[model samples]
Target chain A: MIRILLPAHLRTLARIDGELLLAIEGEATQGSLLSAIEGRYPQLLGTIRDQITLQRRPFLRFFACERDLSHEASDTPLPGPVVAGEEPFIILGAIAGG
Target chain B: MSKVRVLVGTRKGAFILNSDGKRQQWDVSGPHFGGWEIYHMKGSPVDPNRIYASQSSGWFGQLIQRSDDGGKTWEPVGNKFAYAGVPGTHQWYDGTPHPWEFKRVWHLEPSLHDPDTVYAGVEDAAIFRTTDGGKAWEEMPGLRGHGSGPHWQPGAGGMCLHTILLDPSDPQRIFIAISAAGAFRTDDGGATWKPINRGLHSQYIPDPNAEVGHCVHHIAMNPARPGVLFMQKHWDVMRSDNAGDSWQEVSGNLPTDFGFAIDIHSHEPDTVYVVPIKSDSEHYPLEGKLRVFRSRTGGNEWEPLTKGLPQQNCYVNVLRDAMAVDSLDDCGVYFGTTGGQVYASADGGDSWNAIVHDLPAVLSVEVQTLP
Candidate 1:
């Protein structure tokens, strides 16, 4: 099972409380995990990433295993802890507003 | 009891203000969709319970929220707005060709007769229609595909189609206004369009009387007289009597003509309202006083409505889509300001009061008269 942590607004949108767990059929890369997430919650198709370009929105960041994975490639494999569901892949709205 | 529900969209969230027909003593609901930018919210004229809201953010892109039971509950609808065909480029600010991209929905005009059908005017300049209550949207490309699209440019507000007017007399006719693209009319639904800016003069543009490049801030038409239209341009107040075939300047008497919002009284077709800003560069009212100018003659002669409003030291702007009217016998006028104030004039424009003093910089105001 791969665990993911969504931002507050997205969690409200998906109507989920606490962490979300999903079983991955293929390699647990950022791209595949996002695709699976969107597939499950079709309402979140374009919230975290672009629907066509699949690029992460400028104001969103990704983190896993105490490391920032936002700058990493979408196809790159997630940390082992995140893949094993020991740690959550966090999707965060970037901190900029005062 | 017949009641009035005021739907307000602000910079931070959406608010629902309810009151009886007396127009006094109100009950305020929400900051629903809190922390998100609610660009515009409007209820269908056919079904007052059905409401559509445009919610967007820099991080989450765009979202459409619909409420079937007035403003009590809401659910997210389709957010995707794809342009038709090749999605060609328009003129960028720097004179370069910019590819068309969907940014956000600036306005939503529900069908006059069909509750399920709604029209959306979006930024980056496009019109989208949804037949299944915003579940899906398809572009009416003829407005942009009529061969003059390459010359359309953004007017500081980023190429937004902010106004959409449906002709009540002729269901087949529709009018849409874009910033810096003037106004367009489609006689055959959305299949064909023509520029209706015949006499608009904009000194800022290369050609002062160009047919296609004037920044039309807002356009209002009386349902009883669908052929007559009133427009508040970037620097002039105008009127068209022959269904936009030709326009004549109506910026007469009192104050500057620069403003954003314009609306007509529901009960009186000749009575129109406009908020004059200081100038094209300064968007606020003159001398720190916020006043709504009313022209009972429909054009030229005007009077300022100032009772129950801020008379001094005010520097707020009323956006193009931020004003609306409720069709009560007394005729209530409502508008929201950039300083987070929603003002309501219960007895036409004579007496005014702020329904809410503090919100998140209101972007739009819509009213529904309940039976």
Candidate 2:
């Protein structure tokens, strides 16, 4: 199980004000995490991915165990700490401009 | 030689990047503002020694600080503009103050026309002008004259005024971009504003003018041709030939074709630059790749100029105000990536070199002629 903490906006969209829970069935990577999250919360499909490319949106950031999961592959294995459920993965909406 | 310094603002602090124009010759200093995020900043153009920075922490409210004596020390700027008054102003606050949505100032431009005049685009979706420089700011009521229905405001980021293009030749003819509200101009010294968003693709719909969908992230204009403007809209790149009254798409041929910051050559009207991000997915271009393109012929076509950039998959998010053009004839084009690397092209984007690297996530980059 990969516990995911969402930022304020995503939390509202997912209708979950707190950390979300998702079963990690296959490989753990940015792509997998997003697909899983969107699969669970269908409304958030186009919100994160472009529907066509499945690429993360601009100003959107991903983190797992304090690591920026934005640049990492979706297939990258979950950190041992995350695999252990010590610290949950986090998806953040990066604040830009002034 | 005068030292080259770049200010890199981040959540940790406002950092300083010092370089000697060489490889990895970079020195990053300071969590300058302590823990508060310094998003928008400007080293005083009139007095290069003084620096002005605006900070906000969601609920902590907004505050602008000024540093005299070359950033060695700093102090709060205005009393009315602060949650707590500093010295002259009487306003005070007992707890953290949350800034009004779209209330934080994003960019500060000291008036080249009047040394005492300064203008700032705040998050509250208004443009504030300060006659006494960074002292007190009043919302330019003229902006409200532009039509904005409920559908005109963007979903998020607020349909606020973020770009302020002050005509150096005729200060009265000012151009500003208010995200989803569209591009506007005040030819009579900001007394009235008119929409200039024609031909700009509205991002929310198939139509180009989608009431509140065409977000103009930033706009730049040629100082010589005050009427011409280049704007980076939420959907595409455009140019206004008639002083921002109407626009035409100019992003002819560029990879992915999505980005925030677009810069025009300081001296050349036809030559300009844009940093293209991946449009299919906005996650910092494709595979965290970085590329800054050059359009030597006014965006009719473009060529990728990434000879000396990074080779690894890296997200290079360059803010709207982060890319710059130095005034040298060969025209040095410089930009700082969100990955904290500053790349400079001494020969106009033909070949590049990393002037500095590893600075706290850079927010903005501005270069000036040092005496």
Candidate 3:
């Protein structure tokens, strides 16, 4: 089981309260988790990643176990704490104050 | 009681302002979809309860929100706006071959008689229509496929199809305006189109009278007189009496003809209004005084209407889609400024009042006259 934490706007869009628990087939990777989440909630199709280019939006960042994982490859395995559901993988919108 | 609902889209969010026919007091609703750019929001003419909004952001891409209860509660509709077929290419900034891409929707023009049907004008200069109340969108590629695709260039705002006007008398006819692409008309109802810029002369282009590079800012039409059209081009104020077949300059006796928005009085077809900026490069009012010019004689002569607007050290700009009209017994003219002010003129641009003084920088303003 993998627990994912979406940003506030996405949480309102998907209408989910807390962390989302998903069942992954193999290793808990970012690509597989995103695909699973998009399958579960189709409304979030291109909000996190580009629909055609499949690139992460510049203003979004990914983190897990208090470590920045946005620079890592999508197929890389997530930390053990995230895979074990002890900690939540977070997708945050980078903040730049006006 | 005749009520007025003004749907305002801003850089930060969307706001709904409700008022009675008197237009004295207003009940402001929100900054719904907060922290996102609300490009445009419009209500259905057939069904006043239905409203559609173009919401987007750098982080979340694009989203279309539909409100069935007239700006009360909104639900995200289908945001997938895929261009039909190969989608070809147009001239980029450097005159290079640039492929068409869907960045965001700039306008939402609901059908005049059908709430389920609406047209979306998007950046990259394409028009998409949805018959299922924005649940899905299909591109009407005839506009871009009108044989002038490769020559169309982007303006300072990127090539955006920002205006859509449906002829009320002739349901088969429609008009669309794009930045740096002039104006186009479709007589066969979205199957085929042709450029209708005959007398438009822009000094910026190499050929001052080119057919498809005028950079038309906004166009307006009166339902009673569909043959007569008013346009605010990049530099001059123009008019087309023969339904956009040919245009003539009517920018007589104004402080400066360079402006963004244009509209006609709801009751009078000859009564037109435009906000005059100082120049194309300096996008502020002349001499730090904001005024709206009204042309009662259909074009040659003009008069400044400035009753309650700021007249001292004010330098805000009115965008292309930021002005709109409400068709009540007394015609109401409304416009929003880039400095975050929405002003309303109840007595047909004779006097003005700020409905909301400070919001975000407003992108578009639309009003629904409800019975």
Pairs clashing within candidate 1: none
Using DockQ as the measure, the top candidate is 1
The sequence of per-residue lDDT tens digits that candidate 3 reaches over residues A1-98 is: 88899998888788899888898888788888888898898878789987666777778999989899988888998888988989999999998566
lDDT of 3 by residue, B1-371 (tens): 89999999999999999999999999998999998999999999899999999999878899999999999999888888888888889898888989998889999999998999999999989999999999889999898889898889888988999999999998889999999989999999899999989999999887889888889999999889999999999999999999999999999998888999999999999999999999888999999999999999898799999899999999999999999999998999999999999999999999999999999999999999998
| Candidate 1: CAPRI quality band | medium
Q: For every candidate, give the share of true A-B contacts it also has.
A: 0.54, 0.00, 0.54
User: How far out, in Å, is residue B229 in model 3?
Assistant: 0.8
| Candidate that beats the other on TM-score, 2 or 3, i.e. the better one | 3
Candidate 1, B368: how far from true, in Å? 0.5
Task: Encode model 1's per-residue lDDT on A45-84: one tens digit a residue.
Answer: 8899988779898899998888999989988988899998
Off by over 4 Å in 2: A1-98, B1-3, B18-28, B79-102, B149-151, B203-207, B210-213
lDDT of 2 by residue, A41-86 (tens): 7645555645544556656777877778787765777787776678
What TM-score would candidate 3 get against the native?
0.96
lDDT of each: 0.92, 0.67, 0.92
- Arrange candidates, best DockQ first: 1, 3, 2
Pairs clashing within candidate 2: A29-A74, A29-A75, A30-A74, A31-A74, B102-B123, B102-B124, B103-B123, B103-B124, B288-B314
What is model 2's DockQ versus the real complex? 0.02
lDDT of 1: 0.92
Docking class of 3: medium
Q: Indicate the DockQ of the complex predicted as candidate 3.
A: 0.62
TM-score of chain B of each: 0.99, 0.86, 0.99
